[model samples]
Target: MEYLKVEEGDQREPVSPTGQFLNSEALSLCILGVLELGVPISIDESHMDSLVKDVFLPTNPRFSSIMVEDENGEKLWKRVKVKIKDHIKTPTFPSGLSPKIYDKYIDDYISDIATEKLPVTRPLWQIHLINYPTSNSNAASSMIFKIHHSIGDGFSLIGVLLSCLQRADDPSLPLTFPSVPLSSTNKDSNGLFKKVSRIFSVVTNTVSDFYTSIVWSSLLEDDMSPIRSGVAGVEFRPFSVATVTFSLDHIKQIKSNIGAKTVRVQAKQIQLHWCCSTRGNFAVMFPIKEMIKLDSKTPWGNYFAFLHVPLPKLTDDDSTSYSNPLEFVWKTREIINAKKSSLGVYLTGRLLQVLKILRGPEAAARYIHGTIKNVSMGITNLMGPVEPMTLADHPVTGLYFMSVGAPHSLVTTIMSYNGQLRIAIGAEKGLIDAQKLKSCIEDAFQTILKAACDDDT
Candidate 1:
């Protein structure tokens, strides 16, 4: 196919391999990435209109282009003239509804949109404004950004969102993140014996993990539990979204009390253990383990792979043993460290590339879908700026995001902003109890925090 450019010589390139895997007409496997931001004041449509036309469309050419196929049926991004009004939505509510009713309306509104597919005629994105008082703090308005996963993952999309935001206190200054020190282990060894042993261990573990991935994708699947609906076409099914916020300072205290190396480990430890106890024994699946691999010279696109991280198993006695909850933290740390030492994630990426070359993208998409379909649940996390941010001159009161159209019973997305972590749980609407899941996660956090405090003394 010829690389053609029109009068406007911009954004006429073939879609990346991963992008095709996500958004091909033959196998339309798209992840509708939705981000919800709460604002302290009511939304101004005029300000948002200007932002969409000036700031957003100009930030990335992908935001202004539509995916089209050539004679050979290969997807290419073609620039198009965007109509700002076509992409903006404003839903009205009753005049005198209470805050509680408005909250329910907001949740129902999000689920309604989550199940709908984005049209291919225009740019694959939209913005929704809900100018109603929500029960979450002083959030009188909520802004929803719906973008296709083909444009970018949560990480790069967050960057695009950041481009539209500035420090609420000083728009002249740049946004920053908390100085959380990265944890690393000493690799110094006195003899060749330890080095050789480490290499052998990594090789053995990689082989085992690769084999497990193959089996799980084909023959074996998670058992039918409360969270696993085991239904066909679960991706198209509606899912409920719920959010729970935790103080970063309290998480740090839990880490300090238990002598944990990093706050991330402590936070995930609570979640992994909670899933094992409250829901069922299921491996926590990541549809795209390595979400973004940025090349300094190339523009951002879909660059994601998959991984299956199993939750630590518990026996009947172990399930009842809650006196020492710190063991959960220790076990999770060990499992993560072992995963870091292996090459399973890289191998999975290579395998997908080979499949794309030999069998074609539809097969590759099916393989990817099967990997996600067999799993009971999925989880992903992202980091936000440390300081307060504003969008179109309105202060953001809260921020959280969730991935829709995933073929699973449950998917949890976490993001940290300012000084708190927001955990958004997306679960199958009729099959899973989202509120009960939220309560169980909260219980896990409190259990760990209490145990840490008692042990510190």
Candidate 2:
């Protein structure tokens, strides 16, 4: 790792290994997070200018910088003068349009921008404002933020956004995240034999999983199904984004009845069937949780890695598993627990670092592209503030995000905000019906909720 020297009034920082991989030419990914406002509002370009210059830019220097190669040929962030107007987009829609018409137009606009690559000459981020009443939000306006993955992971970017937002109810009070407990209980009291057995299981599972990841990236690929296109450069294709909302109360009931540990357990259980049902391997992106918990002084960059948690397929012969919601939860829990016990996820991160040093960033990036493309889909979850927050004084009604340019037919992003869970599904246009997928997911949630209620009764 090398850092460029900082002179008086000059700012430059070396790009981390993980950042290099994400921003590489072969695999450039962007995070598209949308903020739905409670009231219709117009964008005051000058006020937004102040917000960006005074508040947002101060949160992270990378927000006002561009990625460039230093004299040593190592990529680094170079601070540059930012024209706030260049980064802010105000999209105009036809006037006197019905709510339904406006909704469709908004969706089309999002899909059109989702597949675009941020310009490297300037900062790799932009904010698009749609100030119109829509049936979907029942609100007057929404804001879509497009930030390059190279700048930071989803969590880091969320933190920066939080700094710019204040509690809608009380601006003086700080926002808080929901407390999710660990699913696994203490097992240190187990007997020596039991401990040894666990160790053996960990080693066995880790080796098997790491090997499977290699094959998935190299020789094997997910089979084409209703949810997967199995086509190269699928990320560049147009994608339709649809969301399904779930009540936190219902999620808690299911967790209590099923003895599940976290909200993700419920989410993954529902997503498992809808995303894929093929014999080929599927992988989900689990962040390196420990790396993401940074102090205030920590610089922002890509700080998380993907865990290739192998997804199981549902075949016609496995009718029992599909029919019994309780049994499905239990099976999903078992798989998640096993993956947690293994070290394959951490080791995979190390392998990428080694590849970066031994080969180069391009080699590592292509490897990442292959690993991501071979999988049927990817899923990510981020917890939002418990209380309502305001962005530039506008009341935020809801929040959700979708990843673009990932080379996968399906990408699911889950966000929990204000006692509700929003699961945004990004599927390739024409290849996968986004609404049908949402229906299946919603049905799955209801089935699980009913089963949990029955079990309680």
Candidate 3:
């Protein structure tokens, strides 16, 4: 195996083996974050270069360099002088463009560019800076990053991207937790029979999980939901992104209504799909703790295995109000807890390892191609700065991002900044309107909120 620092260019290797199977030219993973900075960039060539060389490149090395072709599969990033003008673009909007029109332009722009391949010959990323006068007296601005999926996975990309940001309040502080404090459970005393029972319970759970992962999951076709059918046909299609915002208070409001007083970041997905059957046909959750642990020195790069779960679809029924959501939240908690107690994750990891050795990269890659085509959708939520962040001395008031490519009709990216949760849905336009899904999310939250408000009344 070959190695390279994330900034040093091993974009398509060990960090993410799936990169080898993916389309380098046609499909790309974009980290398009919209920055609503109280301050806007004063576009000038030198300043842009300084921003790139000083602020961006060092933060995520994959940005300034390109990969050199290698045999025996040892990859590395080689640095080239990145021209500021070539990478950063400032596009002017038509005169008298309203904020509403500007908003429309953004949606259209993201859709149009979703399938547009990055220039593979150069470094695999670019940034778009938009600061235009709108119908409102106040002008708006955003910074967009378009990058190849091969470069890094969500976990790595988010860390480095946030590293590039400065706290709007305190530049000296780190964007993420300077150091996350970890907790471990202490062993409790129990009788000898209880200990034996505990061991027996562990063994039985492992056997059951193995049976389900290999037998039940492999044999039974995925169940149909709002997105894909149980036996959904896989196809290569263009994808689009719809960024929607929800209030943080509303999310908590809904959670509290479900009789669960405590909520964690990872549990929100359960809240969305608890009562529904959610399937991950093509997309499976990958366990990456082996490589990217809480204390791993290298924090950037891909490290995941695949697992699938079903989520309940949302509805427009006003009569049911809280019942459905309440059911979902509790069910999600139970299902996710059961999954945690199983050996399915361990089994899948070993299975993929065996596949890689027995079948080789081509065969393994084919499985990814098949799975993504079959499942065609994945959602990942990354929490952003609870406090406002800035870029190049400009205060960023808002931000959201998502990606689109083959075998994926809908890829949802959830991000929260300050007190706002932005649910960005990237999907195939022919199959569904991205806005329709956004409306569903908004409606689901509204009903949950109403339920909570009614309880107060």
lDDT string for model 1 (237-332, tens) is 887777788999999998887777777656667777553533232344333423222222324766555667676666677755544777767777
Model 3 misplaced stretches (Cα beyond 4 Å): 1-30, 73-76, 133-139, 176-226, 229-238, 253-298, 312-324, 452-457
Q: Rate the local accuracy (lDDT) of all candidates.
A: 0.73, 0.79, 0.58
Candidate 2 per-residue C-alpha lDDT over 1-457 given as tens digits, one digit per residue, 9 for 90 to 100: 2233434455788888888888887888888889888787655778888878898788788888888776567888889899888898889888989877887788888988887777777888998988887765566788888988888888887767766788888998877788756456467748888889989999998997788777787788877877788887788888888888888888888888878877776777767754235565456765555222333654566767665765665667787656776776777778888877888877777888888889999889988899989877888888878888898779888788887879889899888888988899888898988889899888888887888889453
Considering summed lDDT, which 10 consecutive residues are worst modelled in model 3?
287-296
Question: Which ten contiguous residues of candidate 2 have the minimum total lDDT?
Answer: 286-295
Q: Model 1: residues >4 Å from true position, as ranges?
A: 1-11, 25-46, 180-187, 275-299, 319-322
Top lDDT model: 2
Output candidate 3 Cα RMSD: 5.6
lDDT of prediction 1 = 0.73
> What's the TM-score of each model vs. the native?
0.90, 0.93, 0.77
Ordered from best to worst TM-score, the candidate numbers read 2, 1, 3
